[model samples]
Target: MTLLRRLIRLLCGTDPVLRRMLKYWAATCVLYVACIGMLLVQVELGLSNPAAANGLIAFGGCGAFAFYLLIRANARLKLEPDQLAVAQAVFSLVCAFWAYAISGPLRAAMLIMAVVIIVFCMFALRPRQTLVLSAVAIAGMGATMWWLQAHDPVRFPPATEALTFGYLAGALLSTALLSGEMSKLRSRLKRQKRELTEALETIRLLATVDELTSLVNRRHMNEVLKAEERRQAAGADTCIALLDIDFFKQVNDQHGHAVGDSVLRCFAAAARASLREGDVLARWGGEEFLLLLPDAAPGDARAVLERMAERVHAMLVPGLDGRRISFSAGLATRRAGEPFADAISRADKALYQAKESGRARIVLA
Candidate 1:
């Protein structure tokens, strides 16, 4: 199963349409092999026209080889599903012609194959194309029947021939109409599925991400803290820090809320840049943020927060006219078996201490 998946991925990439077309192609190949096998059985039983049977076998062999080449070149061709369907329809027409020429009594059965081809087209082609292809199949059959009447007038009398053509035409038209309705429904369902998936993704982003800073929001951060607490209880090193921009309200008071927003965005960017790969940064609330550092000791947590503060200071907030953007942070390493809220309360106290001590500093709890 794994190998089959890899093969499909290699041949079709991640395109759902291509994967579906590949399956259709496989089914068609199987159908061709079955037809060839049936022809051989007919020959063995001495119940077939040797010349006609050989012609079909040769045609089927060539068709199979061509289909193999088409599959092999799928990557380079990059054919759309509609294009493949049209090709299959054309192939089916040719097969119908050959079958009609060979199967004297079974000629009507060959017309069913053309109906099947028209049905296949309805899945990938528009309703108009489906109708047009059905017309083409009807025309091909009509022309073949005309030629047969000209060559073997006794075998295909005028009345019987007219009735046969009428029946075949009615069958093809009916199949085309039914298949066309199915095609429209399939397309509608596909469009709805795509829209639904996009809506879900948008909802997910709105729930978990901050609108202004693009950082994970407080809700997601709380979930992460809970998970980290569980891991810490299992003897893992997990440290968290509460970060608050120093005198952020002053920025909004002096420069306007827009500049204050810019500062928050700048601080988020700087902190993100300073943190290592596994660190999780989230907007805790307002001008405050939380940083989760997994597998970090107290010293390591302090170092990471310190570097973040340095980056914010050096990268001065936009519209602040060279005024350094600083923050006060409180670091708390989770103790084994301790609740997350207790750790956060301790960090909050340390944050208060850092703010009371004239701000722009990191205090460890």
Candidate 2:
């Protein structure tokens, strides 16, 4: 049980693609062994020359193992499709020649396999490369057939012209139609994958952002602050600024929550526009907003906060009762080696101080 646990962990440590390949190969090997066993039964029961039949079975078993190795190598190394296509085509042509020496029906089957190779090459390799490879394979097969006939004119007469014509015609027609369809499907699959990835990203963004204010929501902001703390621990300078709308509770009480909500959105838009592009802004909760500034020293952060407070104070948005709206702010820097929660507590304390002193000023802690 301990050994099995270790093996499971070891396998889980690999990339997802490789793990799938390993499972697939293991299943395929089991099926292959079962198939070989069935073939052995047929050899024993039906074949007159058991030795020759066994030899043929061994040859096929060796070829099957070789093909498995090729697939495993491509999966393990993540070889490009073009490389695999060339290797597959060469293997098919070689098998075709070997089958031609074995029997007529076997040769015909191998030719069909060669056509399948052409389809794969057309889909997997560049168009020009596929064309060159197809031409070479055809020429090689023709030359080999002609040489065999020439060497044994009496024993191996030229294949009937009609049969030869039929084979070539069938191979060419199948390759053209199947290869074209496969290429189209490949292109469609790529487009669908791209669209799915884009949709997933859009969903993730929506989940993290507040729709009304277009700022990071409370949950996302908490995550962001924690991540920023980790960065600070790695020697990054960091600061946090908190902002609160002055008399926000009174506005909602006097006007309506609807108008208060509009004011909140407007303030958020203004703040987002005024801050530097690098600043991270979030709706901390209620009427409070938080700004996380990576690489900002205490002085620089305070200066930015003061500017933002001035902007908020000067802005005139109609409140619930058509009055002006404004806000106060607090700024704090993360002390060297300080915990993230402590920095937030310090900033919250400074925010309360700003509220106590007056409603429209910036205080640094």
lDDT of 2 by residue, 1-365 (tens): 59987887574445675455455445534644664464456555652245644555576567656655665566567776466557656755665554454443234444655565576567557655666667666766676667767776554467652365357556755565566676778889999999999999888888899888989987888888777777667535788888898999987887789888888888887788677767888998889998887888888877777677666655666654446667777778888788767777888888899999987877888
The digit string of per-residue lDDT tens for model 1 on 1-365 reads 59999886786668675566667877787877777776677667765688889987887778766865676577789876677678777886888777776666656677777777787677678888888888888888888888888888887676777788899899888987887788778889999999999999999999999999999999988888777766667645888788899999989999999999999888888889999888999999999888889999888888898888779889966688888889998888877777778878888989999999999999998
Candidate 2 has which clashing residue pairs, if any? none
Question: What TM-score, computed on C-alpha atoms, does each candidate reach?
Answer: 0.85, 0.53
What is the Cα-based TM-score of model 2?
A: 0.53
Q: Pick the TM-score winner.
A: 1
> What C-alpha lDDT values do all the predictions have?
0.82, 0.69
Clashing residue pairs in candidate 1 (N, C-alpha, C atoms within 3 angstroms)? none
What's the lDDT for candidate 2?
0.69
The TM-score, computed over Cα atoms with residue i paired to residue i, of candidate 1 is 0.85
